[model samples]
Target: MGGSRHVATSSTHPGDLHIPGSHRFYCTAPCLSWRGGVGMRGSVPPPLIPVSPSSLLQPEPLLLAPSGTSRPAGSHRALRGSLERESFKPSSQPEEPKHNRRQPSPCPRSVVEAAKAHPTFGELFQFATPVLMWDQHFSPETWNRLKERHVPYGWQGLSHAAVSSTLRLLNASANRHLFDRRRFPGGCVRCAVVGNGGILNGSRQGEAIDAHDLVFRLNGAVIRGFEEDVGTKISFYGFTVNTMKNSLIAYEEYGFTQIPQAEDLKYIFIPSDVRDYIMLRSAIQGSPVPEGSDKGDEPRKYFGPEASAEKFKLLHPDFLHYLTARFLRSELLNMQYGHLYMPSTGALMLLTALHTCDQVSAYGFITANYEQFSDHYYEVEKKPLVFYANHDMLLEAELWRSLHQAGIMELYQRFQLENALHSAITPQPKRLAPGQDKWEESLAWRRNGLN
Candidate 1:
């Protein structure tokens, strides 16, 4: 299998580097315009603290379940037994009839009211409705819109037959479990979006994070030793096919031997590549990956034996586009990184929770004080967080801070919660100016072979 690669070249301008393979560049020249020719001559942001090459984690060799080996029957029974134990047991006091139970409202009134009060919040609601999932059959328009704006690596020349086959498989699956009032009894659903930032270390927020009705975790979510701080419950695991595979290879030493598995847990597949669609189909059907980079791979190894269509959800490509255009739009887009640019998995999962849940608390997310924490809580030694060209961490940090001040969500800011909140709301017209420098530094690190 041939994988895609990005090659960078130095340009005449300082901090300007060209990625020929992806046709993207890092523009540092003051006169250069970005994103619709907007002048970016303001002060450049500070450089990201770089980690030595030896400090960076290396991914292990790719491994999959042997082609013909089936998931052991004992594991299935164990999962089934665990589900039965966790199943909701109704109260003895009289149960509401199925018809009488409160059904989920088509549009949540609280969310609407909140949006009306905050223009930024309202804009997000308009762009991406929380109630719907971007499945192949249920959202053709969304799927098409996504295909036009987002190009997954190695999928530029994907055949029409391949697309159709994947969609056909997805169309046959069941719908996702959106916010249902019937399940919660009360109208509100609380959620926690947990990023794997090292700030979570010693935060002792496990009980708080797990208390929410649902919890969303992504990429290298290590829980074994850090349970007291990061929580043990994982209701949803969100990732692109690339991130999931990369995490397994890179963070396997950190205990992410396989994707999170539970009878009721759902996997949100961000369709960054055709491989995601192919893998999702194989997982649901209990078959080996039919073709592509993951050909002959068994899905049951990641998701247990009884994996079903109900356990998988695909993010609509349109929704991702909307997120980038409206909220996390970074200068990187004009640099030609649009094809590779997508919100960090943490950002996507948090936004999903915000749109769907009545109340949300974010744990281990990026804040102004991110430098104080390690790159990830699971690291044996403290490692400085490194910024990469593919993501706009500062933009995300600003958004999270703003959301917290607006009473939209509670971002766990560790010891600097109050300070972070204050700075988020403070008017700083020159904030982005200083932040732009970080991207340049990130590019420098990549050029130095530190990716």
Candidate 2:
């Protein structure tokens, strides 16, 4: 069952960011890495005034029906969760949003600027490109051609209002990039992108991972008992609503009862579908998912009451569109079932880090010898990695291999199982991550009605 909103009609919670049923608001983030249906499609449209507060589906009216009704087996829901675009709740102060951009401890100048473009597209992986979509990106021509076409990536089968309302709020407080450059010491930042692959099960790479200025983690990120292996600091989390919920339901026993929440953490919403927009909006608004695949979902449950506009970011569809086309292109797309493919969530997060951070280190991602380890580092029992059709793990592995060899990023890979197991038994220095105090454990795990 989906979590229901809880609050008192009286809005007198002195320090609380909001009272769910009350007219208050806040913002937050999370993501998952398991092989499941991950929708990845979007564009680099600019932000504009939302079409109309009354119709998130304006300019293009579509049918609306509750998914819970006696609808046909496969009839698509007109009122998608994200597409049910509603204007953001007016904040009492209505002040300009100040995002919680992570400023890691000052370090030497370190920014990623590849000297030459990879031969793949004759373009250096656009490291510092804009990532979030806004009003201007939603041009009429692009919508006319791609709204329902389902081509390169997301933004298909959605109405103008739905997309517009969502983008409008994104520009409300979020920045187009992952972090603020000025926050770093020398305009250089180091980051670690952590995946759940079993390579880190006992690798004891925690000290190395927590050493970076910022860290990105995703998909079944079970951190409690394995802090010695995965570290306790999480600067960013990337995931679609589908994966977040599915991970919660599927991995609850693994101890991932809640997504990591802290003052410094930010969420990167991959607009894989309109549903992502809906969840992102609700998360920003601190209310229930107004409509769509996740109707009645309480963003407050997963994010906590302090959900702020500055805490969230929506991945520009253009980024994904460019990524799949240039870097992670796979032959799977050529097969009859190829259209279902896009980069995995881990790939998206890793690449995002590669583009945004000066130095990138990947931990627990799939390596060439994936069969030697269990599916995920946090798994209770050994299970082979599942190759779902939606992603081509081999292609991603090769891309990482090439990039690692090219001196672009560090991929935590080793050919021998004995060496990996040695990491756990070996003695290593214990150290605290810089600014770890900002990411103290959240108390939301005790709350209820989490969808």
Candidate 3:
């Protein structure tokens, strides 16, 4: 912090600075009206300041929730950017191919269409009564010893340079078409996935946070309220259709409109259900559904026909196996989500990009003091991370912490040597909170088959 040449605006403020021996430059935009050092205490944080007046206070952005509107494009710019980077021009001087491998043929429309129509849930999971093929493919011994499995993949005692190089190759091929030219000329593409954990609430990382070629966000990503802290730009928004819809429904009062939209933003679908798969395909093809149907009447407007099968990239199943074997083991995976199997949706998406990008950074993810903050950094109202039937958030927090400590990624944190203006204010329970009685009701509903 002290090594940079400070660009001072006023006697009390600094404008910009160049760090010695570093490519990174820091800037400080100061306004006379700006009240610096607002603490994260009793008062609720405001939604992100609107980047453009046109984007302010519109109806919650509707997404194609099957029964509802589809989320607009530019939701997953970061992922698209990374994908574009992946599809970039192959290096001018091709290095020795990794092992001996032929270029894979372009996936056929029939295969792509079949996958589009496939039952997403069944494709990803199955009940263990007889144990599905995908579930049984892994040996229990391999499950019992994650570290041992890490050895066979290139991950055993992998160096940063080695990991970086492998990811670069993936990016160059996957995103070669998206970028007219590479950012670094010859440099590897970089991506940063920013979570919306409350740890970013008070952290002043706006400018520094946006330096990556791409940025990713997930559920409850309240940008307006946390703009000063998390920055105003969003490159990608990843979520299962249900999760995205749920967050918008759950956090509507806090200004959780559909994740921000940009002209170049690409919505990356994490297929979780049959409806999501159908809707995403419809969105890409620009097919108009009957207006009087239960779905919506209007032609879906969130995405244009520009999104075609060729441009979409699905996560490779092997990549998910690789992540589970290396970083997320029994202790963390089981603790976070029950059943020591499969990657969490967000984890799967992030790790997919990590395996494909040259460099990766994580933001708003679980930080050390997570329990002391709300579930999301952009929470309109402070709400603790509740354990729902859906997923194990706490265990995920632990995994994120472990990954951060291992230096495999970065987490946003604020430094305040003295008394901070505000502290994290805990949320008080509301009467008959939605989550409080849902589990028991859910059990009854399931027994009656009403769900």
My TM-score estimates for the predictions, one after another, are 0.67, 0.67, 0.49
Worst 10 residues of 1 by lDDT: 53-62
Best by lDDT: 2
Please, what are the lDDT tens digits per residue for candidate 2 over residues 1-451?
Answer: 1355432211111111222432222111112222233212221111111110011111111222221223233211221222322222211111112442333424343323331333321233443345566655567765664464342255566767777777667665345667876677565688999999988898899999999989999867889999999999899998877667666766777887898899899988877667787888788788899897578889988888998778887776656665664455443343333345567889999988876787889999887677678878887788766454346665577566666655668899856646458768864322222332100101011011011
Q: Write down the lDDT that model 2 would get.
A: 0.59
Candidate 1 residue spans exceeding 4 A from truth: 1-112, 127-147, 152-156, 171-179, 416-451
Residue 114 of model 2: what lDDT?
34
Q: How high a TM-score does candidate 3 get?
A: 0.49
Question: Which wins on lDDT, candidate 1 or candidate 3?
Answer: 1
Query: What is the alpha-carbon RMSD of candidate 1 to the true structure?
Result: 18.2
Give the TM-score comparing model 1 with the true structure, all chains together. Answer: 0.67
lDDT of 1 at 186: 68
The alpha-carbon RMSD values of the candidates against the true structure, listed in the order shown, are 18.2, 18.2, 22.5
lDDT (Cα, tens digit) per residue for candidate 1, span 1-451: 1354333322111122344433223333211222222323433222222211111111211111222333233322133222211111111111112342223434344434555477435433442333234343334543453344333312234455565565555542344444345677666777899998988988899999989889999977878989999999988998866567656665777787888899878888876667777888788789999997678988898889998777777765445544554455554443323233456789989987766677788998988667667878888888766455456676688677767766678889865455457666764222322323332222232224322
